[model samples]
Target chain A: METLTIQGSPKTPTVEMDAKSGVIEIKGRSIPENSIDFYKPIVEWLDEYASSPSGETTVNIKLEYFNTSSSKCILDVFKKLELVYKKSGEKGVVINWFYEEDDEDMLEAGEDYQSILKIPFKMIELEE
Target chain B: MTFDIEAWYGEINKGDVIVNHKGVITNDLITEILSIVENKLIERKENTRIRKKIYNVMVEALQNLFHHTDKLPNETNDNFGEKFVTFVLKKEKEDKFSYISGNYILKSRVKFLKDRIDQIKYLTHEELQLLYKLILNNNEFSDKGGGGLGLVDIAKRTGNNFEYFFHENKKDHCFFCLKILITN
Candidate 1:
């Protein structure tokens, strides 16, 4: 039960996760200068957390932009969470993607991710 | 056959604007522009939501140019010399802001470009997402076949179709221009 936080740059987003609270939030842009470097630690943390994962894990993602490389990494993160969900069985993971009302791109981005990942993901629209 | 010198110069200058944008279009330029835009965004009292939208739109445009630009750097083969890509931020009469980018691309690629644009224009936002997923989940990206779903995302940036034009170059290339409008 711990917390991990990393700030995102012009290319990425700030990542904040609280193991005890079971709240994992990824917010901001995601065009990182080095996608592998920025995401390695986050993915590792998720891997570690998945071993003895908490109940009712909620992963919130609010990304404005990400490059093709970063998009791959995000998919990796979701895949990892999918593993966690399978392990937990019935009490699996819940994913929420927040996008502005007018931002059809981001909304569609959420849908794309939703279609690929096995976990339950809800697309939430926030007013600008 | 002699090269058309006037047409050559015109082609070179089609999208060339010699202005110092504090290096707004380079790897070094992104840092400065990001901070300035973030600041301007704060001053306008825009929340994180709107701010992120603007930020993503700008990044998509810049990276598209950075990765796709065909022109060489500082090679003065043409009369206008090696041209630089540009970003012009303007505030119009209705207090609207615009971010525009222009670059040179190979004439040989126009058909591919046109087909992609037309395909995206025909898909609904939801359909575009499904197509993007199918492509991302199945396709492999090669230098030759760049069959990624990124352009659909770019078209989604406007929540509508994008604007673009081409100017024939005297050389074997054409200057491709993309203009995106994100309304506040």
Candidate 2:
């Protein structure tokens, strides 16, 4: 498991997924023109990492904004992680969805994703 | 020509919804628009599931319009430049908000635009997501432009297929009106 670090641009978000560290973070705006293209590698990385089977994985999603396509890509990422969580048979996957306290849209979006996926997702408020 | 834009807007009797125009489509304006549209989705008295869908669709549509508008090359000022963009949100008889966008486009670009829109309209949500992933996965095609997948994004978010009308202008340019009506 190697560390994959991608810097976020004005149109895309920063993605840092370290299979070794078991700390995956996706932040910033993600209105990419090709969201599937942008997320494909990330999803593939997670799939590959699942083979190694980390004891515990924490995926932190802190997106300020993302398009519908990007949202689906995010869902795909979660879906893949959920697979790992089920198969690992260790503990499970810890997913934290962070959003600004005042941003009702972000909070609601996190809740929506949480309800759809089977993973144990905790929607937390960011005081900042 | 002092086009009575308000007069046209006032004729519709869906409901009273007002948009605050900052005279420019800056970051602040985008945020304002997003907030207003999100509030509008809630005010529609829709179920939480439908409201969330509408909110996501409208956000994607507006972001596409803001980011993809034809830009003048090397203009020091970004937002202050000519912003001939239109965003029309209307509630239909079925309580769905039709998120619409109209903007100036080069006359020569209509064929490609029409073809792209047609391709997207035909794709199902899963197919669109797969296509979007395929495009994102391939990096060699970056030189062409990044907007190829934006339409796919819009298609997935928008529950309905896209509608377009090309309005010819006297200045030889044309205004492409794009619309997607998402039901709550």
Candidate 3:
């Protein structure tokens, strides 16, 4: 499968999905006016990637801020990943949720997602 | 029982007005407003935590206003155009900022909107978090792509109850105003 890369904008995040390295990273802000439209393609890519499973998948989510709309879309992306993980015998998929040290809100957001999903999540704190 | 939108708008447009926009709301406009507010907050050397909270709340407030605003009738005397929304961001103190947004809604919808806000008003932070997660996990997004999580998220971030009002207008419409304050 071809890699999916979308450059970040002021209102959206940078997304990179590579099938070869089994790495998917979403960085920067995600406050798109129409989040579904922005994330639809990424979700589709993941669906395709789920077919030919990667040996080990590492997903990194580093976002400064995202609106409620994007939050739902992010969850959709995770749900797709969860499917992949379950099909892969629940061993090789991991999500790294990166947040600034002082951003209690981001930390809580990651925790919220962790509580909802069965996949493993690492809460990585960065220096402000 | 007509409400004076102009007067109410004037009341809120006071003290260090960072942004005062009143007209049609579009996606482009929302983007512009967010950037402007973000830059102003950064320029003031505001705390990063408070800045993100304010920005997040503004995104929800503006998008909610964009989605739920009622179009004005053609024959109305009110100059408020179709999809009219007015929002003001002002600095109330050194570390306090206020965001106020107003838009028209059909009178019939007031009860539902009121009930929703009232339900959120009494929720403690923990309750709000639980409600937020419940709604987020549910696949019941509105026709407008809203999962009904905006207000809850705003309340959770601010850790304060919502202060809202509905003023009746003559043409079977009411003006809904929501006020949120972010303090350091």
lDDT scores of the candidates, listed in order: 0.68, 0.67, 0.89
- Most DockQ-accurate candidate: 3
What residue runs in model 3 are displaced by over 4 Å at the alpha carbon? none
Candidate 2's TM-score: 0.59
Please provide TM-scores computed only on chain A for all of the candidate models, following their numbering. Answer: 0.93, 0.94, 0.97
Whichever of 1 and 3 has more lDDT, that candidate is: 3
Cα lDDT, model 2, residue B62:
62
TM-score for every candidate vs. truth? 0.72, 0.59, 0.96
Scored by lDDT, the top model is 3
Per-residue CA lDDT of model 1 for B89-130, tens digit only, reads 544323244556666677888778878878887778678766
- State iRMS for model 1: 4.1
TM-score, cand. 1: 0.72
Q: Total backbone clashes of model 1?
A: 3
lDDT of 3 by residue, B73-181 (tens): 8887357667988999998888788999888899999999999998998899999999999999997768888768999999898877459899887577888888998
Supply fnat for every model shown: 0.26, 0.16, 0.61
Error of 1 at B72 (Å): 2.6
- Which residue pairs clash in candidate 2? A36-B133, A37-B136, A37-B137
Q: Write the per-residue lDDT of candidate 3 for residues A5-122, one digit (tens) a residue.
A: 9999998899999999999999999987678889999999999999886999999999999988888999999999998899887677999999998899999999999999999999
